[model samples]
Target: MNNNNFLKPLLFVGPHIILFIVFILIPSVYGIYASFTNWNLIGDPVWVGLDNYKTILTDTDSTFYSQFFNGLKNTLLFVVFSVPLLIIIPLLIAVALEHKDLKFTSLFQTLLYIPGLISISAAALVWSLIFNKQLGVANNLFGSEAVWQTTQPYAWIIILIITIWAGIGGNMIIYRAGINGVSKDLYESAEIDGAGPVRKFFSITLPSIRFPLIYTMVMTTAGAFNVFAQPLMMTDGGPRQSTTVLMMYIRDLAFSHGESIAGLASAMAVLLGLVILVISAFQYYVMNRNAA
Candidate 1:
């Protein structure tokens, strides 16, 4: 009977266990192993220990070295630029819509939420046209001469515009859900204590949503690190490759023209994964400690 009980639980979870091993577990292990070797797709992998890492980290004159640093720098730039806006805008909007006097909130929520559901490629295409120098609404309305895609600051702005538009909806929904869970009694009591809206928000609303804030902060930071499509589709990583992120470099190394540099690419990928793990751990530790 004890064995039967254990077997039942295993049976329920067996499919998921098998999938994790086959798809995620095995591939991750292989990719790590591959990072220590010199491999082209058709040739057998030759073990090179830390050579790939050495080249990427220390060989400053090499193309791989330049690409690695440049890619990482751009990825960090995107994360720094996008993550704060992604968190703050949604939070502000969610709080505003939750006000007692606000009406048709569901209608407003649906409108905000719809953009997150749109495909990135399709959204990027629309945005590209909207920023077009010759016929775009933005240019005509503002009487600007600069081509948004090719111009400095303007190029980055357009990318941020689309990213914020598509991303704000999801975080706003999360904030709304968290906001709804806070006790109404707390607000009423604070109101009786002569607390104004701002004081009540700081004392009640923000503290109540601590977990959701931490969760969204971590997830959004991770997502920002993996930003590829927005820059790829909007700027094609141009304006002199200023927007070429780490993923773009990884993709190009592994699958672009000529022989694939699978091993070196794997090394860069592993390094990126480590950077993310460390940053995420630090964020969680700091935020979770503060919450406690």
Candidate 2:
């Protein structure tokens, strides 16, 4: 190949490579290094080797140990509650919208997808008003006397509501695109075989969109594990820190009052990343194996 041929491809992808290195790669490398050190975000990171990891992983009597485990437990709870709904609900909506009888399909799709574009912080403000104890629509419409944010299951309920509302749109759009791309010939053949809607869905539609299904599953699960803003903005990790996810603890440690404990924070972040990586890998493997 001529030099021009080689350089042209580079020209197309050079900016993206540069951006990834500067924004993602370098920072990730530095963060991992920071996790092994004693740093307060200043005075240079002191090389503490595995001290941070040891404290976080085995020092049960340490406050960081309790915070890490508690935050992790709550984070896992949020993931368990949210990921499945994010996948299944969107898939169902996408499949439902594919019906020939459905009118104004684009309008409905746009309405659903729009919420995903709204920032979580802004969306939380609107939801907060709706779930407000006294003046909110939820209480007035139902005529019930219950505090939504300061209660046990209620606090988690509001968080999940906003999360599902804001999240459903993106995954729905992905599923719709995946469904649309599947060949109509397959569906027609399934119909000729006397397959009903439910049967066609399980036998043909799902199999055809397996790639998108797996892609969304892994991505959604990873995102759910990193969940921070929804619980933070919605419930402020309240009702006694029951809603506090790992990210909240990590953030507080990195930017705490008096002195920052960024080394420990970085260690926590690294652990969270490892959890996400391992789970995402497992999801991909299982889905791919089943698909095969």
Candidate 3:
């Protein structure tokens, strides 16, 4: 191998490696270290060992424990409620657009893809107003006076709506790309054998895009676990904190009024990361096994 060839590859990757270490590796190490201490982000961080984790995981009488679990439960609820719709809706839209006879396919795809480009805060602001109790379009259109944000099911509904609206585009595009990559010969063979649309999709499109399916599933699940802006901006973790996802709890702990609980907050974030990691690994393993 030529010295020049090796140096060229390193030169191209040097910036990315530096960025990852500076922005990701160092911060992750510090965050993990901070989780072991009782830091308030001001005074010296005192070494508290596993005290923060103990309180969060086992101290039922402690407020931190309750908040952690509640937030986690809500976060899981959001994942369960939104991930399927996120995956399925986009896949269906992609498949629909792939049909040769679909009119103005580009236009429809463009319309769907645009939402994912909007900032979460901006999208939440629009959704919040739409679902507002008074002077909101939804209430006027439905002729109902229900407060969407501060209500039980309605609170969750609005958050999920915005999430789906913003999320559908990206996964749909991915699915469309995957679907298009499926060999035309396979579909042709299936059609000659009298395989209908559903059969073709299942036996051909899905299997051909197995890796993409796994990738989207893991990515979508991970993103769902980190949900913050949707519930925060839309419901403000309201309706009796029903919408208070785990990220909200973590954010509140580290930055809310009074002295910050950076230590505990860091621990919670670490725990959330562990959950996502484990779940994503399991998803990959299961999908890879099935593909085999």
Best by TM-score: 1
TM-score, candidate number 1: 0.97
Worst 10 residues of 1 by lDDT: 1-10
Q: In angstroms, what RMSD does candidate 3 have relative to the true structure?
A: 2.0
Per-model TM-score versus the true fold: 0.97, 0.94, 0.94
Which one is best on lDDT? Answer: 1
* Cand. 1 Cα-lDDT: 0.94
Per-residue lDDT over 156-242 for candidate 1, one digit per residue giving the tens place of the 0 to 100 score: 889999999999998898999999999999999999999998998898999999999999999999999989999999999989998
Residue clash pairs of candidate 3? none
Q: What is the lDDT of candidate 3?
A: 0.93
Q: Candidate 1 — which residues are off by over 4 angstroms?
A: 1-3
